[model samples]
Target: MFFLQMSGFPGSGKSTLAREIAKFTKAVIIDHDIVKTGLLEGLELEGQDKNIDPKRAGGVAYHIEWSLVDFYLSQGHSVILDSPCLYDVIVENGTTLAEKHSAKYKYVECVLNDIYELNNRLKNRERMITQIGPVDIPEERWQEVINRAKKPTHLECLKVDTSQHVDDYIGDVLLYIDK
Candidate 1:
């Protein structure tokens, strides 16, 4: 079994690739968007979501996602966590979880370098409440996130150029995991 951690910008197809990976491997997907959106909606009904900052919600959602991953791993199931790899804490937590469960830790980074294409994807995609609709973040912050996206240096990281169809590199990705 494997614990695959997906990393990318919002419009870079993390979820889509996660779905494809899960389909082929029967891994359970814990999508951050689904978790975060559910969190915001539940908190919204309680009138507490307005003041819920992204960082706070992200922390909570990640804790919940990690818990689920741990549970699934304990049950001898592979898991695919669909979230941006923006922080070192995320990578550390995933690595720890994988080690604990004796599963291979796989990291895949989706890249869409063209700003125009990224903006187009962001605009055309069906968005969750927590997802950005466009490239509204300040340019420097945007560049920072791109720069911050990373994988553990010691492990093999699969960088998929998502400007092309996923099918093109999916087989190689599967092989990478299988090896």
Candidate 2:
């Protein structure tokens, strides 16, 4: 099975690209923010100590995501996950999920041109609230999370710059998947 996880900062166009990829490839897309936000609903970072930790939110995202990965892989479907998966825990979890299912996995990192565009998108974006919850991460927390986002190396991953034309970037992803 093909498992694709889109990684990038919030409002970096990962979700939009994931939708495009899913449409073209007919793959199942599992959005991380959607899950994270759902898990975040009614739950404010309440305190600056425990609740504000990005890792804490990531830990929650990891379990939910891996579970879905397992479920979809068992059904023999390719999975496309869209989220700001910039933490080692997320990458490690993705690797673990792939190993457990013996499925081929790919990581797609979305690169935005600038913070201005990203902020604009985030401010106007409408996210889906699934089983997780509604996410209302404050500006400070958003920066904190971005600063903590892990940058992937030339391991078993593919990076796509979303600032480019969609067709061009997506073509690269399709080519990578073909290989």
Candidate 3:
């Protein structure tokens, strides 16, 4: 089994690249936004307050995401974890999960070199509503997220510039997977 973890800021095309990789690898995608949305729905179903705290929901979603990764890996299936993964703890936990399953772990970091383009992408409310559902942060907050992201130093990661079409890098990603 192989475990692929994606790290990138919002609107950096992490999910897009994950899907492209999944098409070639046939890996199951554990998208953080989808999981967090589900957790929020579960909270609503449980009669919790209508305005559920994003942080609390995100914590539960991450827990569930890791559990799902473990479960799928245990079943000998490759998994693509699609998330920002800005924190070291998240990367460490993913590494641990991969080791526990005796699977090859790979990390992919997507980046947009042009800040203006990234901000423009983030400002697309329709796209955000379709993908992440109204969780778009203001343009000013994007820098904070980028500043807080701890780049993975301990592991060899593939750095992808997602400012252009991601298909150009699919072959490279496939080669990495073969490694």
* Top candidate by lDDT: 1
**lDDT tens readout by residue for model 3, 6-64:** 98877788888999999988999999988887777777799999787787777888999
TM-score for candidate 2, residues paired by index: 0.74
Task: State every prediction's TM-score relative to the real structure.
Answer: 0.93, 0.74, 0.86
Off by over 4 Å in 1: 136-145
lDDT for every model? 0.90, 0.70, 0.81
Candidate 2 local lDDT, residue 118: 66
Pairs in steric clash, model 3: none
- Candidate 2 per-residue lDDT over residues 1-179, each given as its tens digit: 77777787766778788888888788888876667666666365543343545557657876887888889888888888776775676777776777777877788777764556666666676644432222456655665655555644545677676776688788888878766
Q: Candidate 3 overall Cα lDDT vs. reference? A: 0.81
lDDT of 1 at 7: 96
lDDT score at residue 161, model 2, on the 0-100 scale: 69
Q: What value does the lDDT take at residue 65 in candidate 2?
A: 79
Q: Please report how far candidate 3 places residue 39 from its true position, in Å.
A: 1.1
